[model samples]
Target: MLSGGSTGVGLTARDELESTISLARTADKRGFHRFWMSEHHGMGAASVSSPPLMIARLIAETTRVRLGAGGMMLPNHSPLLIAEQFGMLEALAPGRIDLGLGRAPGTDGATAAALRRGADANDGFPQQVLELLGFLDDDFPSGHPYRQVHAVPGPWQAAENRVSTPTGTPQTWMLGSSPYSAQLAGQLGRPYAFALQFGDADVDTAMRLYRENFQPSDALAKPHTLVSVSVAISEDPAEARRQAGTSAMAMLRMFKREGYLLLPPDEVQAYQPTMQERHILDAYTDRSFHGTPETVADRLEDLHARTGADEVMLVVGGHCASLDREGISLIADHYAMPRSEIPLPVAAQ
Candidate 1:
């Protein structure tokens, strides 16, 4: 996943976005199937404050690699606007777009209110999601009132507004760090991507619920899951730690108080980690794939098998710029897929 540099990390916002785009282009050249960017706000570290626009811009600049929000926090914006924005992106990138929706307030309450303006603060997110579906689906009759409200980047009311690819349009996925999102994905018959970065260890339970309760629908003939893994790789684990400092620290500040993710590796190498920091980081340790190519492969295999995930979406943190090229190459090689044909797979209907 592409992140707006970590909040307490050293890199500036501009650098984060530019570097993320550059790395994505390289990943396309490396044959990775999906490229997901994160969305956040009120956090000083990450500049990817807005996900939909970022995806739209990134899609315009790259050819392969399905682009989407690791997730768009649905509670932050209007369902109509979200549909319209993604509708336009889908049109531009065609089958390459993936809209992974999340129900959390991406930011704290104040920031959330500012984004939604005078809209209902407590508006039902589930109800909003249903409305969003109606906007994206073209089968809606012309007489529908929402059809008259045009989503600027794309037409929201018509099926024809879909993103066209050599084969078809973009697909949608549901993202969650908890069981709620997993169950919702199952009910909707959509693919699910879990967020393990927040140190959430209940992924197994969530995944199980998703698969077991999944109801077959026209969008999906069977169940599928994507597990998000935190990956940091370098020839030397020590060097990797240095690059991950700011991000590690950001996690520390937000979740703890003492350490930082952007600190020089040698410095943190000597200092002792507190029990709380250790606990928090340990929770995120599930798919902790770090080190060289050999190490990465082993971790990847283990994570895949443990999660029973059909795909493993990665979240690269800290000073990830320097590691992007090599990291993407290493991952693509481990997957055994050639550096071509990285389009989103056609979902079974």
Candidate 2:
């Protein structure tokens, strides 16, 4: 499951870290496949600006769960720097680090421009990804200009390439909400992950295009596809709708150009949307699953059947940490995830 490091009412930065750590521990104990953190800048809803920084902390705290960036925006930073950072992570964690790359800015235009230092935003997403992989693999072609440059502490060890190190390489993933990224990932033979959580995407169509166009590269032997979704499960129908309301309000505000600020549940309960908003919320409800464990699980099953997803990454949320944790716990239980050694008590209690 992917944790966006959600920040809710009265949640402090310290609390955000603690909650994420707690969630990671629980996921690790439950044997969840991975625990990825999102990267966002200048956003109130999410607190983590540097996923790699948090991942470094998480690696020391959790023993089993694969920790990674839900994505690091490729347009916002240098590919060589990312290779060094993730390479370091692989060195520390061995087989447990994943580097999910995205083309979006992950922030407001102003902030994105600031992060990129006025560089061209749409210039070269696919090229940057290839550069990053080349750095990670230390395999630049002979004619490439930057071929001599190497990411230190990288996959390659020794001065003259005569020796090797046991430091594992991070698995590279391409994450997107659009067909462009899907097609690129397939053509490059990288694992493709689609963000269905807050995307206006045709997940099945995207996946099909990816699989049909896939070409094996050094990173992958065949097409690998994963879907990310947000789930909200509640036994009480009212509560489930309430949870969906928060997300709706956030989207409503965004649609109106107000921004992605999340309103409190009480405020959302009192909100009345326009005809346009009503349509948007209905579409959102159909895209995501919100109900009891059984109901949500069935929806996820159908989603998988439709998308032919090799894996589904749950990007969950709720009004608060407790509720969010409980929602994730419910889904985990339905999937028969073993109880964490350090059970999720804040939610359970």
Instruction: Give me the candidate number with maximum TM-score.
Output: 2
TM-score of 1: 0.82
Candidate 2 local distance difference test against the native: 0.80
Output the lDDT of residue 335, model 1. Answer: 65
lDDT of each: 0.68, 0.80
User: Which pairs clash in model 2?
Assistant: none
TM-score of every candidate: 0.82, 0.92
Best by lDDT: 2
TM-score of 2: 0.92
RMSD of each: 5.5, 3.3
lDDT of 2 by residue, 58-119 (tens): 88777778899989998888999999999889888889999999988887788888888865
Give the Cα RMSD of candidate 2.
3.3
Model 1 misplaced stretches (Cα beyond 4 Å): 1-8, 116-123, 139-169, 244-246, 256-274, 281-287, 340-349
User: Which window of ten consecutive residues has the lowest lDDT sum in model 1?
Assistant: 340-349
